[model samples]
Target: MKNLLVILFSQALVNNFMLARILGTCPFIGVSQQVETATGMSLAVVFVMTMASAISWLVQHLILNPLNMGYLQTVAFILVIAALVQLIEMLLKKNSPGLYKALGIYLPLITTNCAVLGVAIVNIGAGYSFVESAVSGAAGGLGWGLAIIVFAAIRERQQLAPIPKAMQGFPLALVTTGLLAMAFLGFSGFNVAKFVGM
Candidate 1:
C-alpha cells in the first residue's frame, strides 16, 4: 500500500506527464480552450492510459519475453495503444456525441500523445508489476488532466482579464505552462518514497 501511494504521488505530481516530464503538449494546449472539453479529453486519456499500460505490460511479459522478441516493444506498444484508442473512439461516438465532437481530432491524437506511450515504457523499464503499471498510467493521466483543466480555467479567465495584445495567446499560454512546470519542479528530490515508508 505504501509503495502504491508513493508511486501515485510521484507520477501524478513529481513526474507529471505534462508539467514535469513535458510530454503531451498538443492536447494540453489545443484542447484547453474550454474546461468542458479539457475535462472530457482528460477522462478519455485516463481510461486509455490505464488500459494501455495494463495490456502492454501483459504483452511485454507474456509474449515478448517468452519469444525473446523484446526488441519489438515499441511496435507492440503502439499497436496496443492504437487499438485501445480506436475502441474508445467508437464508444465515445456511440454514447457521448457531444464530447465526441468536442474532442475533434484530439481524440485520435491521444494515440500519438507521447505521454501515454511514455508511461507504458516507463512501467516496463521500472520493472513495475501489472498493478503498479496500471497505477502509474492512471496517475500519469490524472496529472495530465489536472494540468489541462487548471490551464483551461486560467485561459478562460484570461479572456476578460485585459492583457497586453502582444502577450495574448500562445505567448501567455507558454508562459503559464512554463510557470506550472516550474511549480511541479519544486517536488523534485523530495523523497516521496521515504515519506511513504517505502
Candidate 2:
C-alpha cells in the first residue's frame, strides 16, 4: 500500500506528464478553457491511460517479448492507445453529449497524445509490474487533469482581470504555464524514489 501510494504521488505530482515533462500540450491547452470540459477530458484520459498501460504491459511481456518482436513496441502501444481513445469517444458521445460537444476535436486528439504512449513506454523501461503500470498511467492522467483544471481556472479569472492586450490570450497562458512548470520542477529535488524505498 505504501509503495502504491508513493508511486501515485510521484507520478501525479513530482513527474507530471503535462507540467513536468510537457507532453500532451495540445489537448491541455485546447480543452482547458473551462473547468467542466477539462474535468470531462481528464476522466476520459484516466480511463484510456489506465487501460492502455495495463494492456500494453501484458502485450510486451506475453506477446512481444516471447516472439522476439520487441521492435514493434511503439506500433503496438499506439494501436492499444488508439483503440482505447476510440472507445472513450463513443462512450462519451453516447452518455454525455454536452461534454462531447464541448471537447470537440480535442477528444479525438487524445488518440495521438504522446503522454499516453509515453506512460506505456516508461512503464516498460522502468520494469514496473502490471499493477504499477496501471497505477502510473492513472496517476499520470490525474496529474494532467490537475494541471489543466488549475490552468483553466486561472485563465477564466484572467479574462476578467485587467491586463495588457499583448499578454491577454495565448501569451498569458504561455507565461502561466511556464510558471506552473517551474513550480512542478521543485519536486525534482524531493527524492521520490528514496522516499518510496525503491
Candidate 3:
C-alpha cells in the first residue's frame, strides 16, 4: 500500500511525463489546442500507458529476462504497446460508440507517443516489480492527462490574447510548457528511489 502510494505520487508530480520527463511533447503541444480534443487524447494515453506497462513488465520478467533476451526489450515493448493500442481502439469502438467517437482518432497516434514507451522503459530501468510498474504507469498516465488538460486550458485562453506573428502557435505553446516544466522541477526532491524503499 505504501509503495503504491509512493509510486502514484512520485510519477504524477515529481516525475511527470510532460513537465519532468518531457515525453509525449508531440501530443502535449499538438492536440492541446482544444480542451475537448486534449481530453480525448489524455483518456487514450491513460489506457495505453497502463496497459503497456503491465504487458511490458510481464514480457520482461517472465519471458525476456529469464531467456537472456533483455536486448530485445525495446522492440518487444514497442510491439506490445502498439498491439494494446489497437485492441483498445477496437474495444472502445465496439463497446462504447460515443467514447470511440471521442477518443478513437487519438488511439492510433498514441502508438507512437514517446510517453507510452518512456513509462515502459522506465519501469524496466527502475527494476520495478509488476505491481510497482502498474502503479507507476497509471500515475504517469494521470500526470500526462493532467498536463494536456492544463495546456489546453492555457491555449484556449491564449487564443484570445494578442501575440507576435513569429511566436504564434507552437513556439508559444512550447514556451508555456517550458514554464510549466520549470515549476514542476520544484517537486523533484520527492524522489521515487527513496520514497518507494528502493
* Candidates ranked, most accurate by lDDT first: 1, 2, 3
- Estimate, for each residue in 1-198, the C-alpha lDDT of model 1 and write its tens digit: 888899899999899999988899998999999999999999999998999999999999999999999999999999999999999999999999999999999999999999999999999999999999999999999989999999999899999899999999999999999988888899897899899876
Overall lDDT per candidate, in order of appearance: 0.94, 0.91, 0.87
Output the TM-score of candidate 3. Answer: 0.89
Tens digits of lDDT, candidate 2, 85-161: 88988898899999999999999899899999998999999999999999999999999889998988988888889
TM-score: model 2 vs. ground truth:
0.95
lDDT of model 1, residue 135: 94
What count of clashes does model 3 give? Answer: 0
Name the best candidate (by lDDT): 1
lDDT of 2 at 78: 97
For candidate 3, write residues 1-198 as lDDT tens digits: 877888898899988988988899877877787888788778878888998999999999999989999999999999999998888888878887776675545568788999999999999999889989998899999999998998899999999999999999988988999988888888887666676676
Off by over 4 Å in 2: 193-198
lDDT for position 168 in model 1 = 93
Q: Which ranges of candidate 1 are over 4 A from the true structure?
A: none
Whole-model lDDT, model 2: 0.91
